[model samples]
Target: MSGLDDVIAAETSLSEVDGLNGRLVICGYRLEDLAGRTDWENVLNLLGGRMLPESAALRERLGMARQRAFAETRWLDDGIAALSITEGLRALMARLPDGEDQETALLLAAAPSVFVPALIRCKRGMAALPPDPALTHAADMLAMLHGRAPRAEAVAALDTYLVTVSDHGLNASTFAARVVASTRAGYTSAVLAAIGALKGPLHGGAPGPVLDMLDAVGSPEKAGRWIGEALTRGERLMGFGHRIYRVRDPRADALKAALARLGAAGDVDRERLALAEAVEREALAQLKVKKPDRPLQTNVEFFTALLLEALGFPREAFTGVFAAGRVSGWLAHAHEQIEGGRLIRPQSRYVGPKAA
Candidate 1:
């Protein structure tokens, strides 16, 4: 039972990660159908069992929720500002009241967009900008972070990223959230638990390093050499490979396409995207030759690094931005676990010394 590989912890209709076939289905729609075609709000509604038409109302409610969460920024201080963005988020989220209602879910989902930007501003000695309730969620997040309205292409790219990551089958953070929710702790607590789990490097922390790897590689001409040398040193390439996906991760392609679109719209650095693509190719070629048995391919974190970097987020804030998209999934999973009404208590075999 190492790492619960192949274990069916619980049943969920939220999303399915088909690592074998290289497909993702979120609430009956293939990822490709919804990712760039629709907005994150619609995907959020779909995961929550609401009809797509209701996304408009959900958007409005989420907007109001962000406004409400903004008032709590009065508690942000020098101590909180000194912490990492994710930790700062946890500290602020602790102030939220525990509850298991739809309103609480919206609040939990909206909290990251509010708190992350505020924490970034506070860290830089700038005043936190209030969220505009009339703007869409993705737009408002960029707007709040940069203190201006985001351009249309940036909004679409951000929205696509959020939707693409809205949910996946029982990832580490989602499982942590569900475990806490099974205890009836409350949505806020469950979300807090999920955020703590995502803080780990193995889960949500590699995107920043992906950017670092790109910086070190510098140009497409050096990609193969750097990748080969890194392989020789027995180093794990940051964005390639996954625990479950034997094939290329579908989310990776979705994100790569988003980055391409951003480049086409002139909102991102086209040369940077070209460099990333070169790096990806070299990494894939080197991985195939070196690993041989393992199908190590690019994962979501690869393009996630590029896209977020192009969008003006620093490396340290990458995980927090990931949390912004993932919170919706965490809330949905929490509600589902709460509805199931069973504590996620598992038995562990005592392999320690048996003699007494």
Candidate 2:
């Protein structure tokens, strides 16, 4: 029962994470097929059980939802600005009215994209920009954050990241969303619960630290020495392993390829990318030698850090950005749980003292 290993909590058709085979299928499409070739709105539509062409309508709805979230949460003053990015998002999301419909889902999904950038600006003493409904979801988010239109390559990279992390089979945050939804509490409440779970270090928070590790290693030549020392100290390497993936994480490859594309467009630091690749090789070799029995290869967070940093997101806001992408899956899972029409309560055995 520890860590609920192999527990079948709920059946879902949204996305499947095949850890053994290093494959990810989202709504019947392989992740590699969707990551760069499609937009995040299309992925959202697919998760919602709609056709790919319906992305146009979903894009417009999401745009309007962003506008509403921006207008209603205009109270992002010094009080809210004092909080961390993720905390600020949670505070704003708490203001959304309770509901379980698609409209509610759209609002919940849009809140992070609006609030994360706005919070980033607020922290820096700048005004928040409004969403441009005409642009794609990823482009608009980048435009709002940077106060201008982003390059096409940047948008594509961001969209790929969103699609890549949109959903994994019953991750901690998605499960939290489902558990809250099983009570029929509303999509907003469920999404809020998911964000809380994602804020934890073991879940959606590792991407930021991955950058820190890279900075500490400093260069490819030092990578082996730094990694060896760190392993000697028994510190867990950020972005290196996953609870499910025994082989290399497929999402890591997807994002790495995205990073390479961004570099090709002259948007990313090629030297940094090269250093990261060298470090990855060193880390994998070290892991293999240190723990021969364990198959600890690279996971999604490895390239996620490099890609998002290239896209100009601050490290502290990484998890909030992750929530923005993942809210789609959370909402979809919430709807699925509501349809099942059962409470998610589980029984636990007594391990403490028993009463007479």
**TM-scores of all predicted structures:** 0.97, 0.97
Most lDDT-accurate candidate = 2
> In model 1, what is the error at residue 160, expressed in angstroms?
0.8
Candidate 1 structure lDDT: 0.89
Per model, state how many residue pairs clash: 0, 0
Model 2 shows how many backbone clashes?
A: 0
TM-score of model 1 relative to the true fold?
0.97
Error of 1 at 217 (Å): 1.1
Cα RMSD (Å) between model 2 and the true structure? 1.5
Candidate 2 lDDT, tens digit per residue, 22-75? 999998999989988998888889887631125647778888888999986588
Local distance difference test, per candidate? 0.89, 0.90
Residue range 4-53, candidate 1, lDDT tens digits: 99999999989999999889999889999998899888888888763122
User: Which residue pairs clash within candidate 2?
Assistant: none
